[model samples]
Target: MHLANAPSARRFTGKSNRQARTLAATLVMLLGLSQLAPSVHAQEGLAGSVKRGGVIRYGHFQEPACLFGGWVQQWYLQRQYSDNLVARNEDGKILPWLAESWTISDDKKVYTFEIKPNVKFTDGSALDAQAIADNINGWLSNDPDLRNPTAAPYLGESFESARAIAPLRLEVKLKVPFQPLLNVFAQSSQGILSPSALKRGLAVNCENPVGSGPFIVDKWHHGREVTFRRNPEYNSAPATARHQGPAYVDGISWKFLPDQTVRYGSLIAGETDAIYDIPAVAWKDANFRFPVLRHLTGDPPLRLALYTARPPFDDVLVRRAFAYSTDRKAAVDTSFLGSLPSRATVR
Candidate 1:
């Protein structure tokens, strides 16, 4: 959650390890303090004590293909309309969402979940163990017609079955011990779907989705924007949520602006409260105004694949040379404006 540091502007020069460590520590402290200073002001300022009900106009690079959350990989918009079975806190610990609690068998092959009672989808349908089972097991279904192509890739190949043993109880039996099962369940693509919506098939469900999350899709202007309204009935914010009640905003108006300049302009004009995918070059100009939050990890968002079984890449020397030839530090400095975590490993 650290903001961009102003002092990291100087280019690195393969200096002493002690100097590098000292500079890194200073950058982290400054970045953290930058965010902390504003936060303290906001909390004590008039803005913090004001009553809620304003709509947040958020701008992003792209729009989701559809509203069905459980099938899309990079569909960031879907998360507003749906909730995952579990969630991870800032510290990376798993927490309860739709399922209030769960237990794993000693063998680690069986997962039993206790579904939160009286939870209802936006369509007024109750969220029971059966609905949860259908949403999960649906991904594992091998039936050519019933299987979800987009969701299938996210599910583990060893998935066996998911069933409802009681009204508020669900059992997921795996073929093998899946240690990452909880992590998988925490993904937005594994967000629970309304059973009734699933029965209508993917086409109808994607276009018109119903979930028990904090917000419901109010309108979707194809290729433009999607409007969401807060669900008054939404009482179940995951245990890891920042707060226990509904969202502070009345609703959220998501605008899709692919052009980085236009997005920045919109933010500057105060037309949008937040904007994502801010360009590295824009950081200097953006510093006078809004805060820029970047990912703190070193993992590359994308990778260039080389076929080892093929001719050129098959040679270990060539592969090693290719990897060595790549200027990772320069790329990171130029692309991320030198804000990329220094500790991040380049794969």
Candidate 2:
């Protein structure tokens, strides 16, 4: 997806001139990195320091993720390194990406996409209408009993069939009119992959991905790091803010640093350029010295999935009692530093 402006551009100034000055300085640093850093240079300056050419280590709170595990994180990672037909904005609006534009039939059951021309996968394979159809078919093959189980919940409302109409066009027939079908196409699972890549097997392709995103996977050393480089064949320049060419950073290194303390230390010591999932305690230090971007949960309040189909959680009374007896406030205070607000839910 094309970021209209760098993250630094959205800074909010306050009545406090001192705070504004600090934020302005940090924004300058971020802009410098996003501008002066060449597309081939591995090392990028950040926060007014010359950091080394190395991976930006990350500390995930769970076990190593399966690349094709059909999980949200996996999907997120895939989408990060791949492109979808449609893209979603922060406001949940649909925007065109691979598919430049689309039209829906009067009945809303038939959707036609005008595919972008001259798009090529990292593997040098031509990304045409057939390639998109093949990728969808591959996703459909995952279920034993269903024709398109991978797309069931998403396309079930409208999807009847998908077909490639021409070299740069494709059509989908739906069972009914689904207003949010474009939103479904924007999902990561619906990300388009090359036909040849799928033939090599999902597990194998995960280790070595080939996509039309701004970056392409170069190396993935299981538990160590995953390296990515710009896709020279990427043709989404018109849709992105950096319309001149590919990403500013020549490459990106993602190190698997499990220790939060060490990760924070690395960022502070200039050993790493940036770190994700920063803990609450680290926020104070980061605010004072470094640029920090905290992702606070918003309304619709990020849902948590529970196995209600199982025995223990199957009982309604038990669920209600668990909800009533749970010390949510204490849990939030202890775990999330009371930063997370409480929300009312019904059993």
Structural similarity to truth (TM-score) of each candidate: 0.77, 0.71
Candidate 2 pairs with clashing backbones: 39-250, 158-175
lDDT of each candidate versus the true structure: 0.62, 0.54
lDDT of model 2 at position 257: 67
Which residue pairs does candidate 1 place in steric collision? none
Evaluated at residue 140, the lDDT of candidate 1 is 68
How many angstroms is residue 50 displaced in model 1 relative to the true structure, after the best TM-score fit?
5.6
Kindly give the number of clashing pairs for every candidate: 0, 2
In candidate 2, position 193 carries an lDDT of 71
For candidate 2, lDDT tens digit of each residue in 1-347? 01011111111111122222122222221222221122222121222323323223333323344443355555544553566777665466666777888888888888898888888888888888788777665555544321333466666555677779999898877788888878776666566776787677646776776666656878877877767765655675323222325544455555666787776676666555555555656555566665444433232432234467886768877676767776654544455443344342333
lDDT tens digits, residues 108-222, model 1?
A: 9999999888888888888999988888877668754246555576555767889999999999998888788887887666667687877787677766677777778888887
Error of 1 at 8 (Å): 16
| Model 2: lDDT of residue 7 | 16
